[model samples]
Target: MASLSFFIPALGKEPESIEDKIQLAEELKATDFNRFNELLKQVEDSSVNLTAEQHEQFRFLDAYRLAYSGSQTQAVANLTELVKVAKSEKVQFKSLSVLLNILIISRDYSEVFQYLEQYDQMQKNITDKDLRQHALGILALVFNQTSQFDIGYFYANKLSSDAVDGKYACFGMQFKLESLHRLKKYDEFDQEFDAGVATCEAAKQPIYSKIIQSYRVERLLEVDPNQAISLLNSLYQDVEQTSYNVLITLYKTLYSIAYLRNEQLDVAKEYGLSATKNIKEDDINYAILLLYSTLYEIEKANGNFEKALTYHEVLVSKQKAYDDEKAAGLLAYNIAKANVEVKNQRIALLDKDNELLSLQKDLYEKEARQNRLLVLILGAILLLATVLAYRGLTGRSRFKKIAEYDQLTGISNRYHFNNQAKIALDYCETNAKPVALILFDLDYFKDINDTHGHAVGDWALRAVVKTCRNFMRNNDVFGRIGGEEFAVVLPGCQTDKAVLLAEICRDAIAGIDTTESGKHFSLSASFGVSGSDNSGYQLKQLLADADSAMYSAKAAGRNQVATFSE
Candidate 1:
């Protein structure tokens, strides 16, 4: 058995003394096997007098340390025992913190939240700002990992606000900025970044200064690659010897910027390979996919279609994996959108069906009434017959009007568009001429809805559609495709001509002015063009390819035109 040495707390600091020893034990337990063994040796060498409470604290600490530094099997056993012991008495704050830390480090986010609730309850009587800040910081991490950005932002902002002080404020601000970034509020993101930088500077905090500088590099990648590279060079010089997490982040940032700006295939590939090598494979999948995707784009631009396609396939797989969770959100949104569309279509169809039924019923009623009146006035039967014929003609005309056009825009409805597209496709197939399709979507249309209200969004969408219709050729088929998206089928147009025409349409739509709530705004659109290819494509494929191209345009920067190739 090893002899244990202990430091005694001062006479008056009984509870505080016990707390300090427990905290130390928790921290030691969090250390690695070697560190825990070293700590145990130190404990055995020191002699300290402890009261009943202090003895309990030491026992709990020892169990926790054993769990923390032990194998998974041993850790669980020790933790279970410690929990049993701690539960019998009132749980202390120090013990809870240690348990929570272990849960977090183990990535048990679900349990972390449950522990956080208990921690909050424990803090009810404690008014210490430091403890509150610590609790909130832990809570922020929990919310962030779970994609609860709003709640995470709330706690992080509370911790960062001027009400808090010192290092906690800096950590809170960093977390808040991260939450803002995730939410895609880029303008607000920049504001938060600047504020964070200023706070760190004012506090003279080196850790936060490094963190902010690393974030700056990330932002700089969006707008100016050269500036980002220059900043990274300076940062590397300062932290070249330090193998810290921040250093890893900075290296990844540098690699990303270089990969984006470098035009030459060999150079870009070289840098990308270097980056992939430098970062942990599992940690930076998004960055890795981005690199590969960019390289693929470069290859495609250079006309290496086969190589581009290969990289694209890989990129698609990685993107699917990345978007697996968001896939549900997107699918939910799409399903809701589709359901609304189906409902509207069903209503329209029902209205038409009902109108026909009503008209026929009215005609039958009129005829029956006429038959009755004819019996009374035999001489006026001719007049009644003429009146019935006129009503029938008018009813037919009204049904034609309803079937031929959309009620809202007076343009062709989807039924009309589909019929026309099929006819045009048949014509092109017979005549051996090319037909093209252009798909357009308003960029950030949802943001407009969120900011200016849905009514304004609706008005803006209608205005854009109206403008798009005005730009269409006489023979072109155009119709709205759900909210803020539209499709144009151009018969007798080749790929090159379709590209030029799509650009014209994109520019025209971008120039439209929309006003809502006394504020004037301009909107841009992404355009995707697909023409007849020798690969024997169907209408669905044409539409899908064009939509893919449009998304690419949006990704590259909206208000741009992209033509589907291969």
Candidate 2:
């Protein structure tokens, strides 16, 4: 089957000419499913008399095509082998693009970094601005995915700054805005996105124009939902006339915004369904899951609890699958961190142990000398014994305190929270009582630090923590999860009561007078509240729901509270 498929392409094969190979590759990409398998077989055949370099290059292109067609796992495997062979064969940038695309598609971030190093070396031998710009864009995407926003911004800014005209500027600026968004630099996000939109419009880049418009719609939904809805309504009409991926993405975005607004659920559902219907089955899993989750929320809001629960179950299952993958990644990261920490601890402990041994040896020599002198042998022995006892006592006490207390806030950290929360959850579950999780975030915290100093920001954070502590019960658990975010676990609190308490906490922070540099100002927060029966509950799920609700509150407007249900 593979031979037959390759035979057709081989009849017209022109391995000597890159253009012919590129054209033929495109033709192979457009081939039907039955023919695709044949093309793959043909590409794998070794009887085509291709040189080693040509075979390696063809394999890279084949893997790239597979990646584009959504065979991600297979594509990654193929690309890994191709990269090995290409490096050995010293393949150039023309072949490098294929590997780059595979890296981006599979999100092989660490490998992408390694490839960037190779790219630097390869660039010294090639001179193609367009190709270089494309590679830079892909690199920016890799950085974005890996949460390296500053690096992504640096490369993206470079691309835009070096563009002769505004031709590639929009692409670069789009990435810049994305980096800013990820970094939580909302001010820069607004500025860059606006500039990108204007440049794309002036350059008549329709695809980018649509993308910027869609982004604007998304941004408007956060700041002003009514305005976003109006903008999306206009775009929806314009987009309905065309069949494009951007249009599908716009539909999904519009549906999500509308759902969050709690306006026009039926319309949102219709849009979501239509969007997925138009996409290929293999390409629509995430989109479908997202849409169905939105639908579930709408159903719950409308009092269709049974239907909502069904959708929620599906979403939970899907989320579990995603979480499993995330957990694996996190496990790898944690293992690396643990290994480094253990290595350092071992070195420190070894030094301390060796120092103690040396001290004992010195004392033993002194005792021997005293015995020889026949005077103070017993005194030296007593002093050495006292020193050892003191060291043992101090080490145990320090270790115990370190295990119980957080280093930063001097409060109970995640360890304490986990133990206490588990106990509380178990009590609530046994009594069939309610449990609430409240997640709160400081608004405009980055701006506060940029305007006031980091010291002032620290002062503000300490103030917020103090204020929050005043409202907590003796049994409640409060902990900082690092960086301007905090969590509170309330046992036996219902949804309405939890929401009310969250608002009170928000208002308390708002009322606090934080004076920095003799300028008195108040800060506000957004809250997400989730309450559950506590039975068969997962703490992580509660956190996730609370986070989603908090984002909803932020989307609605900051300085507010939102409750999660279903």
Candidate 3:
């Protein structure tokens, strides 16, 4: 509601009134860092003495500056002390807010939930309406991050409905739209999208408006990729001009997916790479997940399985870390909540005892029953927590396995194949051992699918894999890298040995009986062999050379092994 009189105050005429100082500090701390620092210096130098409360408020503002300006260690230390000692309720609340902001910035969800419990306890003592709305708005954001979209939506609705200031209203609407998008409440999202954008724009919060726009793009990406790319192109420059790294990464990731869906491989890879190259360690996990996952798909589509595997691994790792952090955060919050409940129960029991002091026997019996109930409830909570933790661990393991192996054939999928291949190649290179790669495709496989239907085709694929697996050595890496296509990486093997193995596998495939598949279909495969000595010891190059040789075999005649010449 107030504004700074000047960017930086002159030598002596620096706003002397405590109210002006507070207003100036609030205005410039987030938007104009240099001026805020100058103002802080002026406040420290001014001869006019301030009351204790005023000094505490100024200290809180200074902490806000520090937290926002990359000096979070000192800011957190200062705010931790200020929250406990500050006399004014507003200053205490502000300090807590800044501390929460720091944790959020660092993506420390566990500590965030821990502090959130403290903030919840203090909320009842806070009388300021705007501060209360601020708390609600931040709660919405934290819940959104923690994937509790329902709770996030509820808080955002409350904040929006009760907001007197446009700032809170903008944030409320922005997160509300996000929750709806994430929750897949598309009808409601479409209904509220325009109004939310208008509210953010009216508030002059370009960041929030752009965020809402990003949600629209995300939805469009699923249903209308062309439109998503067009909209992203429109917003590209504007997003770049802003300091919001989240939006920047999100837009680029969206562009990558949109282009990938549109079959624009080169452009998609470019955007995907650009987005991931700028990722920061402390950037939000949401952005990281989107960026890496999209890149994985893009690389896979572009036929770059090596890069695809790398991206897939990174995505899984990041997602696991994020889930673990969120779980810890929820655990901390629950622990704090349980402690608060226990303390409240004890206080209530003490009050009941004091009230019924004359009825001593009845009071003692009631207290004993209440304590027993408390113990049961706590034990149940602990058991539920243990079960959930076990489920999470198993769930992650299951997810990882599903991602690594093909569901259809139960062998390593393209991602895992490339990963294993790279490892084998690296080891071979280090040990000065030869490595060979074999690429094989089931010739006329689609004809089988079209003539006998996919059921028989699937059987043929499985049978072929079974036949080939019997010939593979223990150290050889075999995987289904494509539909009707497979690869094998053989370490400590020369080109001739690899070609022999391929011929054996090919003959086995041809000899397989097709009666078990319900319809008899003869299977034959084209094989290509490439060695590290010829392909320069790089997996990509090896794959390329083998692929070229495989096409040569296909061109000459199916069901034969061809070796790379140069």
lDDT of candidates 1 onward, in order: 0.65, 0.67, 0.82
For model 2, the superposed segments whose C-alpha errors exceed 4 Å read: 1-82, 85-96, 106-126, 163-168, 201-207, 245-256, 259-262, 272-290, 321-566
Worst 10 residues of 2 by lDDT: 1-10
Over 230-256, each residue of candidate 1 has an lDDT whose tens digit, in order, gives 787776754444445435544553554
Candidate 2: residue 566 Cα off by (Å): 35
Error of 3 at 27 (Å): 4.3
Q: Quantify how close model 1 is to the true structure by its C-alpha RMSD in Å.
A: 20.7
Q: If ranked by lDDT, best first, what sequence of candidates would result? A: 3, 2, 1
Expressed as tens digits, the lDDT of each residue in 105-207 for candidate 2 is 5444445555665665665454556556665666566565555679889888887886554656767777787677657787877777767878877866655
Off by over 4 Å in 1: 1-52, 63-92, 123-129, 162-165, 198-208, 239-241, 245-250, 262-266, 281-566
In order of appearance, the predictions have TM-scores of 0.45, 0.46, 0.57
Model 1 residue-pair collision total: 11
What does candidate 3 score on TM?
0.57
Once model 1 is optimally superposed onto the true structure by TM-score, how far is the C-alpha of residue 380 displaced, in angstroms?
89
lDDT of 1: 0.65
